[model samples]
Target: MSESTPFRAAAAGRPVAISIRNVSQRFGDAGSPNEVVAVDDMSLDVRRGEFVCLLGPSGCGKSTLLNIVGGLFPATDGVVMVGDKPVKGPLPRDISFVFQESTLFPWYTIRENFDVAFKFQNVAKSEWASRTKQALEAVNMGAFIDHYPNQLSVGMRQRVNLARGIALGTDIILMDEPFAALDEQTRMVLGEDLSELLAKTGKTIVFVTHSLAEAVFLSDRIFVMTARPGRIKSIIEVDEPHPRSPDFMLTPKFSELRNQAYALLRDEVRQAIALAREAEAAHA
Candidate 1:
């Protein structure tokens, strides 16, 4: 059996919010020369209200696994469950995504962008204005409702993107390196805001991030993966509570956990580099 089964079994007693069972994703037809197995035989359960981080080297399939969970597409093998239901396609009401870059329409005002999202989600027209206002306010972007995406700074645009996800009223949020493009300072501040939002909303979140400090500070647990054909290498737990402050980062425990995650990842990252080099030489 695969590594994930044991972990899933261990967490069976908890209220699982997302369950992935032996999922694998391949980029090409099976046995084809171009076939690339991005994820291999992975299984794990995300518990209700938990913040889980998928952390690994650059080419590992962290984001791919997240996409499967969000029903962006079906996995090549195995199944994913959101609660007890199988995910056949996007469950807009139950799941939302905040991507690395802002997905806001360039021509629309911030309010119009949210209206579009709600409309797609089949949210009632009467509730659009109130929900949009509340979500924007939550991200401290309420005053910019009339602004276009181009009018906002990169960080502000991301904040709006996050608000759009939140306003969708989904119970689960999948974030694909949402703060990736920001400077370190802005990323940290947004991390704080996300932590606070998590505490307030109790949403089940699955985040993909490469930053060790960001993972250590924001996650309830971190899933460290292997070099490629990514599988869980180890799981690291952070016992801190949410709405975490900057002071938490200064703690000895923070340093210890961060070091633990790094140590687990170091060899895998080296392996990934070697694999990349081999692939390059083969193509050449």
Candidate 2:
């Protein structure tokens, strides 16, 4: 697609939320044997209010692509545009990140954690309370507002972590394996809740996950990546509408799509492992 192509044509009336044009990321200087080209010449367009998932094997640079989109790291080549503006640095007011590890302050209460995040975003003190409350309620974490991070379960902590991201009130949210640490049951529940929340809020979300099922269940489209140096192998459209139900999980369509993604990734994953082993052998 051309640079002028809309990120999400369906949501064109809304806005072009994120545009990644031929972006690449390399971790070392030229001529270095140890240099790793993490991401290679990938382009994607994410529209406002759309949910896109980056699905790839470990070391396939899914996170690298997300970091470039979030402006957490600069791309070695190509450009990232958020809402038509080039992303040069961390756009705190426009982007919020939910990492794999809970970023909540263990020392502070949940309410306090939100307060500090809002403070960092320079949201007015007067608006903090209401925004914090509203966000917590949206994630169903409102009742635990006064609880400290250590007192919460892994699932609960993630709820608070998600709330903190939402409380930032940013247009785009980038999540990197945010539910990977939770048990399968917890992850399922959280995934359902997240789907519902996305449907209601219409927030543009770009999530990175290894779960084939999660990608099929939650994303409008899933970007299946190749092994490192990572490239876009294929993009799978889920076709299922959001606010998806557990019943959807048991259907043939879901299983069929999941299998398709696995088939596309199996060889790449094996190749990635073989490459790692070769590198290790050379080092030894």
Candidate 3:
């Protein structure tokens, strides 16, 4: 999506919980013929309890940026700070991640999968049951706690995945298109659930999504990005408080914002295509 002007949230006065400065990511060696730069020098701050969406054209390194912030991988340049500390590796206590695919092991029951995650995070054995119960209940998946991952539909499996991430009790969550695979109706329902959950828990979330409507629905502010070697193209503000309803989508304001984001993205997608063709010609 596109915006002509960048609007940084002015003086809401919330403390910055995560500070990302001039972050860039590259694969392979510098200047090598095969080298690919996925992220340019992009920087932004995510405040406590805010939900920020990264929206951009395909291959724009949205997931790459998420991994860097989560410390699942290192950046080629710049730095990410969680609170006052620099992110060097997975910060399990402060950050958690949810992926597009179901991360639950097929053999494990829904309850058991959560137990495994809790064990890895080294939560006390006593807290696992209570935490697991609470998280499942929040997503309305409590009844299926005994079901195996494969037994559930894709939507249900994803719901369990979301519950597991929230159950981890991290103050910050980095999600890489967690709802991308779902059908529109399922995604909308889950988006509603997420908004409500965010209101209750007040965790900071950096969500990556390709859906313009989804971005508008769930984010406090959307970070529209450039093409490959992605950087912030513009930041679009929703100006709505969380626990947003489906009714919001039917409003005039929502349509305007959706069109605006789509307009911004259209040119970037064309540019990305042209660049791809040039690279192909060079290699050919």
Candidate 4:
């Protein structure tokens, strides 16, 4: 339909920006001995400016889903659409990704890394300096504009990685455990910055994370998934506005939402563990 229509008329008047319909991602051939199913028959809709988190146990293909939606690869079945167009391959200008590890080139200065991404996105040279500067300022890393990635601490490097993603000026960002390597305190601070960035830019974000508190703190809605061949088990809404404070975590409501997410994922975590064990035993 038009931009005026919400997916299934469910997402208020916000208009669906990403539509994932019955998408399944697999590797190897079905009925083959080594076949693997990463995601199975899952569907989701992300509205414009929405922050949605995919939370699940190990091997649940949270990252795989993010990859499919970002068009790093197409799904094995079903389709993922950005606006009205089906995602066939990388949409560099429309989507950007920040992964678990810092992706900055070690040899390049921070400014050079932004230039590289700008080239890939076909961003104009005139916009490069302004975009890079604005993104670094947002993440409080403007002082390190000339520094190389190797010179920064892990947390600092990740901040620049996130800034590069922002500088690309995509409407959507897919982050797969981008803060997974950091200490709890650092992750919290970065999460706060991300929330503020979301409020400021109105960009759509699909974040995959394993931390319950992080998911509860950062997400507008958390989509919890089952074990391998991942499928959505629950969708929990934070029901709060953007630029949320750390004080929000101190409230009973935050605790309640976190507990609910844990309850939903606990079984899935166990199931994932059991499946891994069975697979190992069969091989043995």
Candidate 5:
């Protein structure tokens, strides 16, 4: 493992891009019967340009944590600092999101969608075309610029979605299973594309996913969380560099990391299932 990669050591020396300190999220009033704790006290630092994955059971608040970091909403406790700015609300210029579902407006052409994002980010009109072209070309979607979202297949639209996120030119991207709906083969291909993007752009990424292989393949470090009232169970380092080849997955290190992640989550998954069953019974 030590000879396989130097990313882990290199990551430690990078400046922190995101600082999450004692963060917790709770839904409903404190002490109420309906109160739900989505995240418990959690803290971590994501280094500049590092790709980190939040992986755990279904109800483990991975998405909640991502949203908190992105400032989609406030966390019930603690603080999140992106660079020197404390995240009180959405920092559109510094952050972007790519979710599982395609967020493209069906009526807009691919080019129009990028235009809208750039406009919202207040990027100069002069840079919009160049940014759009570069981003789309990076994802192999430049030819589809004039096509509407509905005109493209799921995978194509996702590529466009990814391209749009990149064209926003943010320093950080928070992704919530952006490739979850795609077929396995398409997902793998997109994963590789994402790796290349990471290497080329050097953007910090915080991704939430349940797939062990995806976590192992794409992350510099994987944060495996416990079930609801989610907390970090373990942080597993992949120790690999970006623009990774699929051939890396054929190696023993990949298998070792994947198996380790699974072992951590297996018990948490069962616990989440049991909690769901209990909730159903109580409602019944």
Candidate 6:
């Protein structure tokens, strides 16, 4: 038999950038009727400069977990630590988030959006122009610097959104299905660009995604979550190096990893769908 590869070695002695210890998130107080446990006793560690993906069916609370890690919302139980410090609120200086929706100001030009984001991060005014130019160039959006968000295509807008996040110069970047709205072709292109960007920057990244291929292609490890009251079901390692090529997507190994993830997730997705239908029926 071939020797099995060690999973921990993928991280190769990198320090943990984000740590979630038995974290649980419930929307309402204990014994409350409207309570919803969005996450349940989930523990995860993301190593510095690693790309990790949170993959799951809908309602599995992947975004909720990312939000908690980003301190957009606090967990009801347990704690989150970023680079050895407990996260109690938004850590703008250490973390950046790219949501599924474009949060860019529609009236603002692409460069203006980046300017505003840096302002929010309290970056020095003198550094804004150079930093914005550099980040946009990194994402290949330097040409559209003056275009308003509305004028850009969905793919272009997302590129700008990504640029804005990178311009913040945070050590950790948390993405909540940032490519969900893009078409398959656009997603693939953006994913490739993102993979290259990660390789170049060595920034720690945690991305949330529903696409199995996307997860397999972009992540060093995939964290699969169970349905509502979400918990980590399994962690699958992608043994490939980053700056992954389109040819990798066509390889048998890529499909095998993607299929493994799908197999683990198929039943959970059905259950989530059934639960949603039941809830809808009750409401009706």
**Candidate 6 clashes between residue pairs 3 or more apart in a chain or in different chains:** none
**Over 4 Å off, model 3:** 1-11, 279-284
Q: Assess the local accuracy of residue 32 in candidate 3 as a C-alpha lDDT between 0 and 100.
A: 94
On residues 165-239, what C-alpha lDDT tens digit does candidate 6 reach at each position? Answer: 889999899999999999999899889988898888888999999999899999988888999889988888887
lDDT of 3 at 74: 90
TM-score of 3: 0.94
What is candidate 3's lDDT per residue for 40-111, written digit by digit as tens? 998888888889999998888899999999999899999999999999999988998999998999998999
Name the lDDT value of residue 97 in candidate 2: 96
Taken over the whole model, the C-alpha lDDT of each candidate is 0.90, 0.87, 0.89, 0.90, 0.90, 0.87
Better of 2 and 4 by lDDT: 4
**Can you tell me which runs of candidate 6 are displaced by over 4 Å?**
1-9
Candidate 5, run of 10 with poorest lDDT: 1-10
Residue 84 Cα positional deviation in candidate 4, in Å, after optimal superposition: 1.1
Per-candidate alpha-carbon RMSD to the true structure? 2.4, 2.2, 2.6, 3.0, 3.1, 3.0
**Candidate 2, 33: how far from true, in Å?**
1.5
Candidate 1 residue spans exceeding 4 A from truth: 1-14
Predict model 3's lDDT versus the native: 0.89
| Sliding window of 10 residues with minimal summed lDDT for model 3 | 2-11
Q: Write the per-residue lDDT of candidate 4 for residues 164-249, one digit (tens) a residue.
A: 99999999999999999999999999999999988888989999999999999988878889999899887887878888899999
| 10 residues in a row with least lDDT, candidate 2 | 1-10
How much is the lDDT of residue 73 in candidate 3?
A: 85
User: Alpha-carbon error at 189 in model 4, in Å?
Assistant: 0.7
By TM-score, how accurate is candidate 2? 0.94
- Residue clash pairs of candidate 5: none
